[model samples]
Structures are given as C-alpha cells and as structure tokens.
Target: MSPACFYGDSSALDSILGISRKKTEGALGQHPPSVSYVKAEQDDLLGLQPDEPANPKVLRVAIIGAPNAGKSTLSNTLLGRKVFPVSSKVHTTRCKAYGVITEDDTQLIILDTPGLTSPTKAKRHNLDRSLIQDPWDSMKHADLVLVLVDVSERWAHTCLSSQVLQCLSRFPQIPSILVMNKVDLLKKKALLLDLVTELTEGVVNGKKLHVKSLSRTHLDPARNNPLPSIPACTPENAPKDGGCLQEGSEVQRGPGSDTSCDAKASDSGHVLGGTEKAQTATPQVSRDGKIKKGWPHFREIFMLAALNGEAVETLKRYLLMQAKPGRWEYHSKVLTSQSPQEICENIIRGKLLEYLPQEVPYMVLQETELWEEGPSGELTILQNLLVPKETHVKMLIGVGGQLVSRVAREAGEELMNVFLCDIHLKLCVKLKK
Candidate 1:
C-alpha cells in the first residue's frame, strides 16, 4: 500500500508553539516574543521581584541507571509535568534532557540522562555516543546523583548493574542516593528488606551489623557467604589529607581541588577509573578497587513508584532540603530546556515506541515536514516517519493503517494536553529510500 497519512486537530497549538496571536497597534507582521519572554518582561514592567530568601538555593541532580529504569518518569513526576518521553523500550531517551522545578527561592534542575551501557555493548549495538558519555558528563556537573534501581527486576536483587557500579565508583565525591523504584510491583514486603540488606551488605541507618545469608539461592559463592564487616566510610572518618581512604590506598588531593583517582583493578579483572573526591559512604570495593556490592555511601534510600507518583513527593522534598545557596540557572517559568519542535518529536517517538512492535520503532526515523500557524490560532504540523525497509513500513502502517492511526491519535491528544491549545498534526509513513 502507499504511505499512510494521518492528521490531528486541537485548539491550543499557538500557545505551545510560542506564537503570539494578539496584534499590536504600531507594527504590521511583527510578532511578539514567546510566552515565557513576555511573562518575564511583564514582571520587569510591573517591578515584580521574587521574594528572595536569605540564601537562594539551586540543586542540579543527575539521575542514572540501567535502561528502562524510570529515570524520565521520576523526573517528570518531580517537575509536575511530562516534558520527558517515556516508553517500555530501552534507551527511549537518546541523550541528556533537563527538567526544571522552581519553588520559592529554591530551583531544582534535573538532568535526565540516557541509560548506562558498557562500551562493548554500546559499540556492538551501534548506539549513540551520548548513551555512554552523557551519564558521565551529567555526573561531573551534578551536585547530587540519584541511582535508580528497578527493584522489581530479579537482577537487581543480586547486584547492581556494572554501569551503575562504575558511575558510583567514578564520582564518589558527589552525594548519591539509592532510589528503589517500582516498589508497588513487588508483592512480598519481606523480600524488599532482604534485597536492601543484600545490596547494602548489612549496613542500615549508618550502623554496620551482620546480616544473615540471603534466603534466595544463588550460584555465585561470593554472594552466598557472609560478607566481612567493612567500616562505613563517612565524611567524619574520611582521610584528613583531603582525599578518600579506600582500604590500603590513599587518594591524595589538594584542598578545594577536584582530582581523578587512579584506575583500580576489579575482582572480575575489569579496570574502572575516573575517580573523584569521596564525600559520602563508600561502596564495598574489592581489594583491587572494584565495587563488589551495593553502594553503602548513599546518604539516603527512597522507595517509590514513579508511574503512580507514590512517595515521589517525599523524595522531592528531601532533594529540595539538600539544596545549598546558589543562583538559579533558569527562569522559574521554564519547565525544560527542550524546544517546542524537540518536544513534539519526542512525544511522537514515544508513541511510536509504545505502539510499534519490537525493533520497529528503533528503526524508524522522524522528520518534521511543516510547522505553521493556522488562521484560527491552531497549529498545523506535518511529520514523516521514515522506515529503512518496505516491510517495516507495512508493519508501522498496520492493517488498513490502524497502527499508524492509533499512534497519531494518541500522540495528538498528548500534544494537545501539553500545548494547551488546538493542534493539527499530520503523520505520514514512508520508505526511507
């Protein structure tokens, strides 16, 4: 069949597109600044100043974890808006996206990054370079790091992903938190405690105690045996020489200077490097400098379901409280750094990922053909979905074009909600060649 085309109509398109519908008296064809710019300008005209606190605060948090670990969901929940795209497919976020939350004198900037993957796996799959570098870059600029783990997954109960371990080990200086996401899916509450114990290696509430062997049977002898008691590395007991003390090695550093620690060999013979200052509790590292268990240095542990937004507020409050005195980087009205076109593309991509079958969505490329304002203050958008193979185009269009239609309709509704205006969206599926 020929390429299928679908159209979406909604009322709030002009607002979302940052276009001004009201005409001024003096100039012809002179459009006003965007809504955000106008609002800021109005504030200036009215002499409206923020009630600045004694110490205005800002916190930049980087959320990192394995693929599909609810990082984007949590970020949207915290921001109280769905600016980030989310789907069941892994690597839905191709690069680092920023979400902003401003309350009173505090502004929290969330760095929603692409999921972490090993270098080999990334190269083998020919994934985007951002998938490997973005997380580290986010960590370098972050004041705090949230390590989100999908607790419902069985793999989480055994050990954290190697990529997660690498992140924790690399940026030991930044205060990190352990967020056990998707807790609502886990039925047995007792197993949650066991999983925590196993991950934390019997360290709870800043106290170290002997934890019995986990009830779950595992083939790895290292996990089955009782782990040795390692002193919890807190800032109070950290090395006085302005560096983190790990077992026998001393990470030396000058005062107020950031330095990288030498690469240490892991128990598995992997060499992990790029170390920073150690400010929090250190994870249980192998003698050769590899992380063997969960990061014990997490200043806090939170359990929440990002999908339902349960306990997310509590986490948000905690992060807010952690903010220190700093100037706000973004205006309070700004929700994200993404442009309108980027947002629309992500929404459509998310829908395609949700509606299309395995590997098809990943293989599809999206291009915006046209974006213009209609006479009645509606947005008209035309986008194309380019598939590499003709068979893939058939799959995207579905029988009688039902699949593509569903993707278009749902995406339009979401776009309408996001823009708060009427939108006319057209989608066409075409062969890439």
Candidate 2:
C-alpha cells in the first residue's frame, strides 16, 4: 500500500498511526471512513526490520546508557513491570538488565546494559568516572542498539563524550538510536536536537564517525498517560459476509459529530475511526466518491503505546508487507536468556554494584552467612555489618547506646521487609586499623 496521509480530529492522530481507534472514539466520536493517500516520505524503520514469512519477527534491541540516565525507566516502560532496580543514585545497575515484549505471536527481547567507560583513568584525571567497557563487550553482538543520554544533564564532561564515541565505534554496523533520557528537565528542544546532530557525527579509534538517530525523547511525556477511552456504542450496523461493508454496514460518528474532519488513511491498517476490538475498516467507496472511515482498530493502538509500540493491525500489515507468511517465527517470542539463579549470582558477584562508591563515605558492607527456610516459605538469615576504625564504630554506637538502637532498628526493618520473615539480624562494628 502506498504511504497515505490521514487527517481528522487532532486527538484522532494519536490512534491513527501509532495507536488504534476504538481506543480513541470517546475523545473523537465514531465516524464514516475518510480515506486519503499518505503523500509524505519519512523514517519508517519499523518497515525495515527482520521478519518471517507472513509473520512479525521480534526485534532484539539493546539500550546502553550512562549511569542514572533513566535506562531503567525505558526498560520498565517497555516491560510494563518493575523488574530492574531504579534510583536517583548513580550506578544502580551493575549487570545487564533484560525485558521482554510479546504480542500477537511475536516476542521482542530487550537488553539493557551497564554504562561503560574507563573509570580508573577518569578518577586520576579529575574527570567524570567513565562507563565500564565491559557492557560494550556484549554490544559486539546485537541486531540493534540504542544509546541513551540524559537530556537533563548538559552536554559537558569528557567521560560521557568518550563513552558515547566508544559506543558508536563498537557498533559501527548495527543501527543505533540515540534516546535523550530525562527530557522532562529540558524545555529547549534545540539542546536535544543539537545533541542529536553531534552524536550522528561520533568517532572511531579517536577518528570522526557518523551515524543516524532512530527515535528518542529526553523522556517520554506520555509514558504513563491515561488509556484511550472506548466507545459506549458500537456501529448501528456491522460488516457483511466477512468482507467489505455490505448493504447497510454504515459505521457512523457519535452523536453531535461532524464529518468535516479530514479522513485519515492510517498505516496502522485500520479504516479511519473504527473501533479496534470488533472489526478492521476497509475504506469502502461511497456513491459520492469520498471515502468514509471503514477500519477500526483503536484498542490495538492504545495497547501498543502502553506496552511496546506495535499495534495488532501494524503487526499484520508488517507481516504481509514482508511478503513472507509463516506459521512460526523465532525472534518474536521472549526467550528467557538468564535464569533466576543466574541473575541472583550476577548480583552477588558485586559486578553490578558499581553504584556503591569505592569508598562509601558513610556506609559499610554486610553479607548474610546462612539462610534457614521456615514454614510458609519464609526465611531467617544472619548477617554482620563490618566497619573499620574504633572511633567510627563508637560514634555509630553513640553514648548510652542511642545510636546503636536507631541503626539496629533500621537494619532489622530492612531485613524483615526483604525476607518477609523473622530476621534475627545482629549488629556489631569492629574497629580495624
């Protein structure tokens, strides 16, 4: 199908392209099909992806970002869950983070990795601590990669710049999209636009390199927006014979609605202004030669915006456009790459704990020694918080043990919350040196 420009209610655009319509009817009222050909050419990367014969293939995407760059937010939004740790503090992530997207027999596995740069060298030069290159090691093998930048932070500092260049260098071949994270902090879009231009001109081996930006936002303003409203009434008429609108299949607008709005021919594969749940609208020609809204898949559009950005109609069209139909596809399904045990081990390795400074100014390290499982699947664990220097320990203990009481109470509460059982957590600070 040729690219078609869709016009209608301003609110309707939300569902017309990326979103579905039944999801937006309450806001824009039902309508007859308004069809027009999309006459513009632009970036449609979704159209240029790996697919199967008549099936939508999952797109494996990796997101690489600086410490505390809202990588977790993007991951959480994509997964529609809170599996990874998120914090205002830097280095909340140490190992690679994973999220999966599965819809309409297709699954997309997403990988989020630790920000990589040179830390040892950065500290010596009084520069920003760099992203550890360890994560980039994985980028060596990715179908697609997304490099994220904190739009909230000004484009200064050599460490991040170095890491950004390093990223482009590593994934010179794979398509990469630069996502300007935390966009809520910046009002001047020029800053982000300018940053996009500069990043497209990154470097390799300290030499100038160029690339393209996929899709981005300082932050997705609509990340948690309300779900699109559904209609209270279905079309007074329905489609006929599992085919185009028969004799009386007239999908009409809601009460007090006008047909003056531009008829949209959406690539989402839905006829303009049709409900998403029940039927797919095909712009049926009227006796007057003007097309009325025939396709309605609005619910599917909202679903895509809420989860990963793939509507059901788009999925079908994507499958059909590839011209390859398939009963099965490998890439579209979410495959568990790492097991629970493996994830736990990765965390315990202290590899992902880079968020903890080398010299934690006011904190210390503690490790549990044993775990005793109890009835109802509860657990009792014993641990000791270790500290150095007698003075520090005494200071923590406080005169009359007041300090110890507060500290012990806080620790016990955390333990109980984490294990959800009786925590016989003991506290003792030994002075070393």
Q: Write the per-residue lDDT of candidate 1 for residues 239-358, one digit (tens) a residue.
A: 333212122211222243222111111211111111223443556567886677676666556667899776575577668778889987766656677767777888899888888888
Off by over 4 Å in 1: 1-54, 209-284, 287-289
Candidate 1 local accuracy as lDDT? 0.65
Off by over 4 Å in 2: 1-56, 119-131, 156-160, 187-358, 361-366, 381-383, 389-433
Q: How high a TM-score does candidate 2 get?
A: 0.46
Q: Mind giving the per-residue lDDT tens digits that candidate 2 earns over 63-93?
A: 7766666665566555543345454555555
Clashes of each: 10, 41
